[model samples]
Target: MDTIPDNIILHPIGVIRNTTKQPFLVASAAGLTMQGDLAPTMDRVRESEETISEVILKGEFTELLEGIDEYSHIKILYWAHGVPAEGRSLKKVHPMGRPDYPL
Candidate 1:
């Protein structure tokens, strides 16, 4: 066995306004329903030739939604998980269900 040297480091950029301090509420509410209201800017849903999708901009971040309608496409980054956990590494392939190759 060999020890690996650490070369990369990570730092926190900002904190979230919504916090789940209560344990039971977080567990029971998991996957049941979503809280809070959707922003009005997201009212205009866009549809492609084969698919339909809405641009959701919620909460305090809604203030930055001004003048976004002029763009044809937008990129969004999000943190899906509120807490980190030990899980499988990043995978390039489907977990044994895909019939086609994925890049």
Candidate 2:
């Protein structure tokens, strides 16, 4: 089997600033179940539709965003810094933690 190299490294180029203070759902350390009620979760989702977040790039990386305003939409990649280490190891999960969905 191929082994991953040990010298890999990553650095954040920017940070997202938003008003959201809590997550819509919380997963157990084992990633088997989600805590919180579905109604409130949906409410948060609705609230987020009207929320605006700012993505501030580091001073050194600011130039990389030149001409970004010309695009109507863009894709963003982010790290889930709040997830527990064990939760990151989950191989499968129900969509939106809805048990009715197949894993």
Candidate 3:
């Protein structure tokens, strides 16, 4: 396999806007932790269902979204900007911080 370069650059095409101010998962000096239960509560699930989110693209990228309405579903790549530089180096993590799940 080819080795990845140490220096890589990325430009944001758009931003995700949501009502949720704080993140559900947080990475601290100790390790990754959740603000709530390992599994989302019923209320949280309902809140997510009710929440409305939008992807605001940059002016240059706005035209790329044309014809997007024709698709029933689309994929989005999210960037975790809140994570500290060290947190990105984690080799493994339990899915949703659930111990039952293999790392």
Output the number of the TM-score-best candidate. 2
List candidate 1 segments past 4 Å from native: 1-49, 78-88, 94-103
CA displacement after TM-score superposition, residue 68 of candidate 1 (Å): 0.5
In model 2, how large is the Cα lDDT of residue 9? 65
TM-score for all models, in order of appearance: 0.32, 0.81, 0.78
Each model's C-alpha lDDT? 0.37, 0.79, 0.75
Angstrom error at residue 102, model 2: 2.5
Candidate rank order under lDDT: 2, 3, 1
Whose lDDT is greatest here? Answer: 2
Tell me how candidate 2 scores on lDDT. Answer: 0.79
Q: How accurate locally is residue 69 in candidate 3, as Cα lDDT from 0 to 100?
A: 92
